[model samples]
Target chain A: MVNKENKFNDIVTDNGKRIRRICSYYSPNHEDRKDMYQDILVNIWKSLDSFRGDASINTWIYRIAVNTSLGFTGKAFKQMQMIVDVDTENLSLLFDEGTKEKLEQEAQLNQLQIELNQMSVIDKSLMSLMLEGLSMREIADVIGITEPNVKVKIHRIKEQLKSKLSGGKHE
Target chain B: MNNSKISQDTNGMGSFIDKLKREDNNLQKIFKILKITYIVLLIIYIPIFYFEIEKGGLFQVVKVVFIALGFSTFLFVFAYAQKKIKKISYAEPTLILLKKTEKRYRPFHLLDLASIPPILFLAIGLGLSEKTFLATKEFFSSDLNLSTYLVEARQFLFSGEHWFKMLAKTVNEFPMIIVFMVTGMLIFIFVISFVAGYLLWVSKYKPIRDNALELIKEIEN
Candidate 1:
C-alpha cells in the first residue's frame, strides 16, 4: 500500500506540469483550469487500482485527463443554461474590443485559448492533446479515433488556427 | 463570426467566465438546499407511513407497503444523486463532470417511471379499504339488520327501473350505497394519481435523462 502511494506521488510529481497545461488548454478560465487540474489528480488517484499493464501509465493518464476535461465542459454548459440567463452572443458584444485592437493586446496563447473555447467538445479535446505534444498514435489512442483521423483533424485545426491568427485579411 | 475575430475580443471572455463562475456557485447552493429539503421530507414522511401501516387493515397494510416501496425507490434515486453531487469537483472540466453526473442519475428516471404505478395502486387500495370499513360500520349500525339490508340492496340493483332511478333509490334505501360511493372515490383517486405522477415524471425526470444522453453523445463524437 505504501509502495503504491509512493508510485502515485511520483507520477504526480513528474507529470503534474503537463497535466496542468492540458487542463489550461481545455478550460478557458483560471478557476475552471484549477478545478480541472485538481479533478484530474483526484481521478488519477481513484483510478490507480484499475490500472493494468494494458497501456503505459502516460497513455492512461492522458486518457483520464482528456476525458475529464471533456466531461467538465459538458457539465458547465448545462449548468450555465440552468443558472445564467445571459445570451452568449450578447455577452460577447459587451466584451468585444474589435478584432484589431484586441489582437494587439492579448498574448498569442491567450488568443489560442479563446479560440479553443469556441470549438465543439471533441475538437477542443483533440486540439489540446495536439498542443500537449502527444504523437498522433498517442492522441488516437486517447481519443479512440484512428491515427489517420487524428492527423487529418490536427492539420485542419492548425490551418484554422493559422487563418484565424492571421486575421481574415490573409498574411 | 470567425475564430480570429472572436479571439481578438477578449473582454467578453473575462466577464463571461465571471458570470459562469457566479452561476456555478448559485447552482451549488441550490443543490445543497434541495438536498436538505429531500432529507427533511423523507424524515417527515417515514413516520406518517409507519403510523398508517400500524392503524390500517389488510388492504390498508398492503397499500401502505406499496406506497413505502414507491417512496423507497425515490429515496434511492435521491441518495444516489446526492452522492454524485458530492463527488463533483467544480474546478474540473464542467462538461465531463456533467456527463458523468447525468449518467449516474439516469437509472433514477426508470425508477421514477416505475414508482408511479405503485403509488396509483396505493391510492386506490387505501380508498377502497377505508371506504369498505366505513360501509361495513354503517351496515351494522343502521335501523335495518344485515339480512334485510342485503335483500333491499339486491332488489335495488336488479329492479332495473331506469339505471339513474335505481342508483337514486339505492342511495336512499340500501346500506350498500356507502360501498358504491367509496368505489367511486377509489376510481377518482386512482385516475388523479396516475395522471399527476405520469405528468410529473414526463416534465421533470425525463428531461434529466435526455440532457445527459445528449451531452454524452456530444462529448464522445
Candidate 2:
C-alpha cells in the first residue's frame, strides 16, 4: 500500500499549479500567501484518506481548495490581517519585460486583479481557471455546476467587469 | 504583451510555489506531533483504567470515571473517523458546500439535536407531576371517605408545628408526602435553571463545543 506521505506527494505533484492558483486568490502578502498555502497543504494532507475517488480528482481538489481558502480568510480576517495586497508596480515588473509599453500593460493587469477581487468567489474561480486555459467543461466540473450555467455566469461576470473597467477609467 | 512577458509572469509564480512547498512541510511536522501525542496519552491511560477496575471501593469510582473517559474517547475517535470518511466519500457535497457558505450560518441549530426535546419534556413532565399530586389528594378527600387520611395529610401540608388538639379528629394521611416530593423536585429544577442561566450569562458559553458545527464549517470554508 502506498503510504500517506507518498499519497500526499502524488497530490501536490499533480495539482501544484492548480493549488498555487487558488492560493494566489486568497493571499495578499507574500508571507500570508505562503502561510495560506501551508494551511491548504496541511488540510489536504489531513483529509486525503477521506477522498474516496467518487468525484474526479480535480473536483475533490477544488473542494479542498475552496474550503481551505475560506478557512484562511476567516482566520486572517479575525486577526484583522489583510491579504498581502499585490503591489501593482511589482506585479507589473514581473510581467513587463522592461519595455516602455510594459507600464501600461502592468497597470491593466493590476486593475484586472483588483476588479477580479471585487467579483464573487465563484466568478473569480471561473475567470482564474479560464485565464489558466482550463476548458469550460473542466471549470464546470470543478465547480459542480452545469456547463450552461458556467457560460451564463461567465457572461454575466464579464459584463460586470466591463462596467467596472469603463467606470474606473482602466488605462 | 509578448510571450517573453508571459514567461516572466510564470517564473514569478514559480518562486511563490517553492515557498508554498516549504510551508507544507512545516504543517506536516506539526500535525504529526499532535497525532503522536494523543496516541501516547491514550496508551498510558487505558492501562491505568484497566487496573482501577480491580482495586475495589474508591477504585470503583475511579474505574467508572475512567470508563466514562474511555467511552468519550471512543466517541471522539468515531466522530473524527466518520468526518474523515465523509470528506473522502462525497456523501453530501452540496450540503457540505452550503454549510461552507457564509450567509447561511446557523450555530445554535446543532444544539437543538440534543437539547431541545429533553428541555421541553422536563418542563412538561415536572408540571404534570405536580398537578397530579395535588389532584390525587383532592380526589381522595372529596370522592372517597378519607377524612382520617385528610386530617393526617393536613399536618404534613404546612410548615411550622401546628399540632392537633388532644382530641383532634385527624383525617390527614401520608398523601401530602407525595405532594412534598413533587414540590421539592420542582424547586430543585428551578434552582438548577436559575444557576445555569446565571452561569451562561457570565461565561457566554465559553468553549461552546457543540451546536456550532455548521457555523464553524461555514466560517472555515
Candidate 3:
C-alpha cells in the first residue's frame, strides 16, 4: 500500500509554492499564511481519497487552493482580507521597466499590487491564476466556469486593471 | 531536493494530520455519545412509558405520542444536519461549492422551525405525564373552560385590587404561583434560546454566509 503520508508529502512538495502563493493573496501575515498552508494540506488530504483523476491533478490542486483561500476563515481572515504584498519584487522582472530605476520599478509593481488587491475577490482570484501563466482553458477548468466565461471575465478584469492603474497613476 | 523545502516547512504534516484524525475521532465519539444518550433515554423511557401505559388512559397515550413526536422530529433534524454536513464537497466547481456552503451557513434554517410545535407538544405531554406540578395537571385538565379562565383572569387582574395586593394574592394562591412559575420558566427558556441562537448566528454562521454571498455575487456576475 502506498503510504498516505508519503503521497501527501509528494503532493505538497509539488504544490506547496502554488498553495503558499495563493495563501499569500488572502493572508499577508506569515503566520496566517502558514496556517492557511496547513489548512490546505488538511483539505487536500481530505480530498485526496476522492480524486478520480477526471481532471488533471494541477487543475484539482488549483480548485482546492482557490476554494480554500476564499473559504478560509482564520485569525488572518479579518486581519488580512486583501493581497498586501506578494513576491512582487521578482514580478518586476516580468515587466520591462525600460529606463526606470529599480526603486521606481518596485514602486510601479507596488502600485500594481495595490490595484490587484482592490479587485473583487473573484476577480483577484482570476488575476492570480492568470498571473501564474495558466491559459484560458486551464483557468476555466480550475475555476469551474466555462472557458468562454473565464475569457470574458479576464478581459473585463484586464481592462479594469489597465484603466485603474494608468488613470490611477499611482505615483 | 525541492522536497527538502517542503520538509523544512511542513515536516509535521504527518503528525498534524494525525492530530486532526484524533480530533476528528473525538468529534465522532461525541456524536456517538449523543446518539447513545438519545437511545438510552428512549430505552429508559420505554419502561417508564410501559409502566405509565399500565396505568393507561388517554393522557398516557397522548404523552406517548407527543414524546414520540419530539424524539422523531429531533431525529429527522439530526439526520438532516448530518447529511447536509456530509454532502458539502470542496472539490465541486466554485459556483456550486459556494452555493452549498452558503446554504450550510445560512444564519437561519426554516426547517428548524418545524421542530417548535413538536417541542411544545412534548413539553406539554411531559408536564402532564410527570405527575407532579399540580398546576400542569390543572392547565391540561378538562376543567380548563375558556370563559371560566377568562373570568378568573379578569377578576384576578383588573378587579379593583391594587397591583401589590394582586401580587400578594397571587403569592397566597398556590395554583397561580405554580402557573406563573411555569410561565416564567418557559419565557426564560425562550429568551435564553433566542439569545444563544442569535449569538451563534452572529459569531459563527453569519460571517461564513457573508463571505459566501460576496463570492457568489462575484462569480454569478
Candidate 4:
C-alpha cells in the first residue's frame, strides 16, 4: 500500500502542472477548474491499479485527463456556457513582482484560453492535446480516432483559432 | 537555474493535490446517496409486484410475468453497473474504463423495449378475460329465455310462417352483435395501452438511451 501511494504521489508531482493547464483550458472558472482537476485525480487514482506497462505514464495520464474533462463538460454543459468571473486572487499568485515579459506572456495565454473556451468540446480536447506537445498518433490514440482524422482536425482547429484571435484586431 | 519554474510547478501541484484530497469526502457522499437511492427503488418494486399478482386472474398472471421480466432486466443492468463501478481501479486505463462504463449502460436501453410486451399482454388479456366472464354470467342467468325462444322460432319457420323467419334471423344476429362489441372493446384497450407505453418509454428512457449512446459512440470512435 505504501509503495502504491508513493508511486501515485510521484506521478502527480511530475505531471500535476500539465494536468492543471489542461483542466484550465476546458473549465471557464476557478471553481469549475478545481472541480475538474479533482475529478481527473480521482479517476486517475481509480484507474491506477490496472495500469499495464503498455503505454507511457504520460500517455496514460493524458488519456485519463482528457476523457475526464470531456465527461465533465458533458455533465455541466450549462455551467460551461456561463460567463467566468476571473478570480483575481488566484491570478495574482502567478506573478512574482510582475515583470513586463511575464505579464505579456500571461495576457497571451489568457487570450488563448478565452478563445479555447469558445470552441466545441471536441475541438478544445484536440487543441489542448496538441498544445501539450503530444504527437498526432498519440492524440489519435488518446481520442480513439484515426491518425489522419487527428491531423485534419488539428489543422482545422488551428485555422479556426487563428481566425478567432486575428478577427478581434483592427488590422 | 530556473527557480521560478520549479516554484510555480510546486505550487500548482500542491494546491491541486490538496483540493483533490479535500473533495474525496464529497465524492464518497455522492456515491453513498446513489447506492441508497438504487436500493430504495428496488425495495419499493417488491411490494408493487406483489400487489399486482395478488389481484389474480389469467390476465393478471400474464401481466405479472411481463412485469417480472422487465424488473429482472432492470436488476440485471443495475447489478452490472454496480459491479463495473466497483471494479474501477485507480490503475485502469481511462479509455478502457470509459468503454466498460458505456457497455454497462448499453443494456438499459432495452428496458424501454422490454416494457412493451407486458403492456400489450395485459391489455389483450384483460379484454379476453372480461368477455369470458360476461359470457359465463349470461349463460347461467335465470332470466335468460333464449332456448325456448329459439325452439318456438324454428318450429314456426318450418311451418312456412314468413314473420317467424325474421324472429329466427334476429335471434342469430344477437351473438354477432356481442362478438362485434367485444372485438371493438379489445381493440380500444390494446390501442390505449400501446400509446401509453410508448409515451412512457419516450419520456423516461429515450433521454437515458441517447446519453448512453452518445458516450458509447465517443468511446468507439
Candidate 5:
C-alpha cells in the first residue's frame, strides 16, 4: 500500500500539470475541471498496479489523461465548452521581461488560440498535444494511430492554420 | 519522493482517490456483481455434479452438461475480461484505448450474450434432472453401488408407467417453469431498458462513445 501511494505521488507530482492542462480544454467550468482532474487521478491510481516499466511513465499517464478527458462527458460533467486560457505564466517564463517582441508573439499566439478553438475536438486535441511538444511518433503512440497518419493529419491542420492565420497566404 | 509532501501539495489526493472509488457509478457495481456470479456458479456446479453423478443415467447427463456449461462459461468470462484489461495498456496507443473505451460504453454489450446458452442449458438441465429424479425415486432411496443404480435407472427410464407418471408430474408443476421463464424474460427486459435508459440517457455515454468513433475515423482517415 505504501508502494502504491508512493507511485501515485510520483505520478501526480510529475504529470499533474499536464493532466490538468488537457482537462482544461474540455471543461470550461472550474468545478467540472476539478472533477475531471479527480477522475483522471482515479484512473491513474487504478492503473498504477498495471505499470510494468516498459514505456516512459509520462506517456502512460498521458494516454490515460487524454483518454479520460475525451470521455469526460458524463451527466455530472457539464457539457461545458472548451476554454483555452493563455498560459500567461509560461509566457512570462518564456520572455523574462515584457518587451515589444513578447507582446507581438503573444498576440500571434492569441490568434492561433482562436483558430484552435474553431477546430474540431479531435483536431484541437492533436494540436494541443503538438503544442505540448509531443513528437509525431509519440502522438501516434498515444492516439493508437500510425506515425505517417499523425504526420499527415498534423500537416493538414498546419496547412489550414497557416492559410487562415496568414490572410490566405501559405508562405 | 516524500509521499506526505505530495499529499500536502495535492491537498490530500489519497483521500480523494478513496472518495472517487467509493462514489463510482452503479454500472461499475453491476459489472462487479456479474464477475462474482462467475465464481458463485462455478462453485455451485462442483457439488451438484458430485451429488448427482452417482445416479449414473439421465441424471448424470443433465448434471454433467449443466456443470460443464457453468465451468466453461466462467472460464470464458474470466479469460476474456483479463485479456481485454491486460492487452490495452493506457500507455500503449490511443486508438486501441479509444476503441476499448467505445466498447466499454457500448449501449449493447456483446459479452452479455455469452450467458444466454449457459442459462438456457441450465433451465433445460433442471427440467431433465427433475424428470429423471421423479422417475427413479427408488434408485436414490437406496444407497446402491454405481452399476446397480445404473441398471435400475435404465429400467425405470424405459418403463411406460414411470413415463406416464413423469408426464403427470410435469403437468402438475408446469406453472413453475412458466413463472421461471417469465421472471427471466422480465430480467432481460429490465436490463435492456436500464442500459438504454440509464447509460444512454442519464450517463450520456453514447455521445462520448460516438465522439471516440469520430476521433478514430479522423485518425484512420
Candidate 6:
C-alpha cells in the first residue's frame, strides 16, 4: 500500500509540474495559475482510483490533466465573462516606444491562450500534448482517438492557430 | 467570442479550483477530530455509570437517573455538533454572502424523522419502568393491592400527592420521569420540524437552493 501511494505521489509530482508549466503559458497571475494547477491535481487524484493500466500511467495522467485544465478554463470564462475585442487600428495607438516589445509579446501570448481555450476539450488536449512533443500515436492513445484522427486534429489545429495568429498580427 | 477571448477566460479558472481543494481539506480535518472526541467520551463515561450503580444499590436510582440525563444531554449536544458540521460541509460560505445580497434566507434542513421514533420509544420505556418500580415500593410499604398501587401512582402524578412526605419524594423522583417525557417530546417536535423544513426547502425553494449551490461551486471553482 505504501509503495502504491509513493508511486501515485511520484506521478502527481511530475504531472503537477507539467500542469503548472502548461497553466502558466496562459494564466497571467499567481492565483489563477495556482488554481489551475490545483484543479489538475485534484482531478488527477480523483481519477486515479479508476485508472486501469491498459494505457500507460503517463498517458492516463496526461489525459486527466488536460481534461481538467480545459474544464477549469471553461468555468473561468463563464465566471469572468471577459472578452477582449482588440481593434486592429487601435492596437498601434495603445503601444508605446518603451513598452512596445513587452506589450507585443504579452498580447501574442494572451491571443494564443484565448484561441486554445475556444477549442474543444479534446482538441485542446491533443494540441497541448503535441506542444509537449508527444508523438501523434502517443497523443492518440492518451486521448482515446486513433492515430489518423490525431493527424486530422493536428492539421485542423494548425489551421486554426495560423488564422488566430494572423488575426492577432492584423490587430 | 473567438479563440483569443476564450483563452483569457480559462486563464482565471485555475485559481478558483485551488481554493476549493484547501477548504475541503480543512473541513475533513475538523470532522476527524469530532469523531475521535465522541468515541473517547463514550469509553470514559460508560464504566463510571456502571460503577455508581454497583456501589449505591438500585435504590440510589436518583443518582443513576441524573447521570443518565447528563450523559444523554452530552450525547444530544454531540449529535447537534455533528449536524452542524454536516451542514457546514454542505453550506458554502461564499453562497451565504450571495444569499444575503439577494435578500433570501435559507431555512434549516433536518435529517430523517425516523431517528426520533426509537428515542421516543426509549423514553416511554423508561417511564414504564419507573411505574413498575413505584408499584413495587407501594407493595412493600402499604401492602396495597396491585390495582390500588396503579391508582395511587396515577393520582400522585396527575392529582398531586396528598401526603406531605410522599409528595416531596414524588416531586423529586417524578421530575426525572417528566424530564424524560419532555426531552422525548422536544426530540419528536424537532424531528417533525426538520422534515417539514427540508420538504419546504426542497419543493418550494429548490431553484433558490440550486442557485446557491451553483454560486458556491463557482466561488470554489
Top candidate on TM-score is 3
For all candidates, the clash counts are 20, 20, 0, 11, 5, 10
The best candidate in terms of DockQ: 5
| Residues A1-171 of candidate 3: C-alpha lDDT, one tens digit per residue | 136657777887788777777777676677777878887777787677677889888888888887887777522333345563434323332234652243255675577667766667787778777766778998888777899999899887766666665665432
Query: Please, what are the lDDT tens digits per residue for candidate 4 over residues B145-186?
Result: 767645544444345443344356653434323333444445
Candidate 1: regions farther than 4 A off: A1-11, A26-32, A46-55, A74-121, A165-171, B1-108, B117-130, B133-221
TM-score of each: 0.46, 0.48, 0.74, 0.48, 0.66, 0.38
DockQ (Cα-based) per candidate? 0.06, 0.11, 0.39, 0.16, 0.40, 0.03
The DockQ assigned to candidate 2 is 0.11
Candidate 2, A38-110: lDDT as tens digits: 6666666656767778777776777666656644564433232212134322332223244324335657546
lDDT values, one for every candidate? 0.58, 0.52, 0.69, 0.59, 0.65, 0.53
Tell me the spans in candidate 2 whose CA falls farther than 4 Å from its real position: A75-104, A167-171, B1-96, B100-221
Best by lDDT: 3
User: What's the ranking of the predictions by DockQ, best on top?
Assistant: 5, 3, 4, 2, 1, 6
Task: Give the native contact fraction of candidate 6.
Answer: 0.00
Residues B72-91 of candidate 3: C-alpha lDDT, one tens digit per residue: 88878777777666555566
As a whole number from 0 to 100, the lDDT of residue A168 in candidate 6 is 42
Ranking by lDDT: 3, 5, 4, 1, 6, 2
Candidate 1: tens digits of C-alpha lDDT, residues B1-221: 22232222322233322333354467568778877887787688778768877886676577667666656665666666566555644233334555555765553455456656655655554455554566667766767765765555454445554346546765446445665444444565767877886787677666665765775566454
Give the TM-score between model 3's chain B and the true chain B: 0.70
Stretches of candidate 4 exceeding 4 Å from the true structure: A1-3, A78-114, A168-171, B1-82, B86-221
Q: Candidate 4 lDDT, tens digit per residue, A121-148?
A: 5666676677667888888777766789
